[model samples]
Target: MSPRVLIVGLNYSPEHTGIAPYTAGMAQALRESGWDVEVITGLPHYPQWRIHDGYPRTGDPHEVIDGVPVLRVPHPVPHDAGQLRRLGMEIVFGLRAATAPWGRPDAVVVVTPALFASAIVRVRAALTRTPVIAWVHDIYTAGLSETGAAGGPVTHMMRAVEGTFLRSCSGAVVIHDRFADYLRGHMGVAAERITTVRNWTHISEAPTVDTDALRRRFGWGPEDVVVLHTGNMGAKQDLTNVAAAAQVAERTGAPLRFVLVGGGHQRPQLEQLATTTPRFEVLPSVDNDTYAGLLRAADVLLVNERPGLTEMCVPSKLTSYFTADRPVLAAVEAAGPSAAELAAADAGIRVRPGDPEALVEGAMQLHDEWITTGGATHRGGRRYVREVLSRGAAVRSFVSAVAKLLPVTTEHRAPATVNS
Candidate 1:
């Protein structure tokens, strides 16, 4: 009899980037490891507000993918930008998860994309008596509060609740050790309970792109100093600085073209501004293979997250950039986990947030260096990912944790059901 492992989260595949890849990869790997794997999640509205096109609404259940059975539960699409709607979605998903039908998992692994996600699963774990593994994708309560997403009263209350949930978790899995340290030192979670099983990219051996054709297709030139910004276009990005920096780059005759690739609510406004401005091009979201090709094709990969999100979040896209072996130009905090990783990997240069002048200067410096040297020096991030953070690695760590909690019993055979 094999152990049964359950992974719970909100977004998942065929969703792109962010938490989906990690959750889906981990579940599939656990199934490969011979565990009876199940994944329970809310409707996938991620990146976009609407429900994913293929699946039906709440009462209509779906197993959207194969291998591990994915139980797509319900949550209301948030309307107001208000915590009322957002928190309601979390609460609704949690409440509905209680009614979901599935054979009991020997161990439950819940992903904390939000501070509230852990809270919901904590409630579920208490009733089930199952060991709960909390996957820390972001240090959310602190991240949101530090960035002023919540008020003083709301911040204090949510932070306290989140801390309580962290302490309650049987294990807290963070992608970075800095986040784990913050949890141990600030939130009072014991050191042993937190594991650093970071996110990974599925590496490609052969190039998945026709780099030259794609470049021509996108109107990039041989000498166009293309600085590519790929992934979420959202408020957390201090785009005022990005815009201002573009202004500076244009003024200085840097002959650079800024590429904003991917979709989000913030994109249209950013696009409008860039269109009215100069040397900026906004491209729609690309498939994974195309995105990777674009990364390989670009002169420098740019990351422009606000300073506030630095330590609390790790842009998983950085992993992709490093794997692509491209030089980086980052508008991230000068100090923090991201900074440290960039410096350590010698992957890119960082500029302070809200200072577009510094951004222009940094971009100029990187461009000069890249031109002189002819692109990136460091490689092997893909190799590093395959060795350390692959799906196999995450699943082994997950299953071993479950084995500690639920030893397989001699008579414990899995109940037969549809392979959904």
Candidate 2:
């Protein structure tokens, strides 16, 4: 009999971006490391807020993905949900998950984004005497304040709630050291209870594509220097700044063409903005292979964020950008996790956030540098990926961290049965 672990979160496999890949990767890695792993997650609805094609809107809730048993809880798939509406969806999912028939497991790992849902899962874990590990993807309270989503009394209340949920966990895993510090210093979680595991590129292979043909497919010309930004186009992403930079570039007659590839709540507004901005283009999300190819084909990769969004989340796209082996440019706070990560990797250049003129300058600088150096300047990014962000190392670290949280003794028993 093997130790069993259950992972509860709002996102999982088939949603290729954001937290889904990491959660899916962790589940698969745990199974390979000899743990019997199962996941309780919502249906695939991410970057694109609607459910993915081929999945029933309402039907059977159980499926096996990549050999791991998953219970998919149906939840609201809002097209452009406001904060309150989103919270309502989280509550509904949490209630459903808490009442679901998951067999008793030795331990549980809850991913926080669906923070309220995680708290509900924690309460259930308490009843079963199962230790819980919190996988912190973002600090919800900080996000509310940082992104200007909410503040004052609302943020204060959320801080109290988030702190309570994290402190109650047996241990917590954070993706960045900054997050660990935030947990210990602000949230009052003990330092010893937190582990830092950086995210790794989930794309297993470097994309192999004909650069010319790929550019041609997108209608990009030889003279055009495409600066691509992929992933969510949300308030935090502040892609409006990217659009502004494109307008600036067009005015200055720069060869740069800014392309945003992803869907989110802000996509419609960005599309409307794009109609009048010749140098800026918005494309729908692409499959993993196409995404990887786009990363490789572009002259530069971008990470853009709203100004003052310093402490809420680390841009997950940075891992993929490094793997893409292209010159990178970030429009983010100088002190934020994304800037720190890029500087540490020696991967890219960063400009002040919300400054369209500075962004255009940075893009042109990177383009010239890439042309002059023949793309040698950005090799450090690929080297960094191999040396520091290898998937095997990341998965092993997560497995080891999780092992410490499990009970030392267990009865030899058959697999636990699911409740009917």
Give the number of the best model, judged by lDDT: 2
Model 1 residue 124 lDDT score: 73
lDDT for each residue of candidate 1 in 176-259, tens digit (9 for 90 to 100): 888988898878999988778767775353566898888899888897878888877766666656777778888888867778
Q: Give candidate 1's TM-score.
A: 0.92
Candidate 2, 263: how far from true, in Å?
0.7
Can you give the lDDT of residue 265 in candidate 1?
A: 63
Task: After superposing candidate 1 on the true structure, give the runs of residues whose Cα lies further than 4 Å from its correct spot.
Answer: 58-60, 79-83, 203-205, 376-391, 408-411, 415-420
Candidate 2 residue runs with Cα over 4 Å from true position: 415-420
Give the alpha-carbon lDDT of every model: 0.74, 0.88
Candidate 2's displacement at residue 138, Å, is: 0.8
Cα lDDT of model 2 overall? 0.88
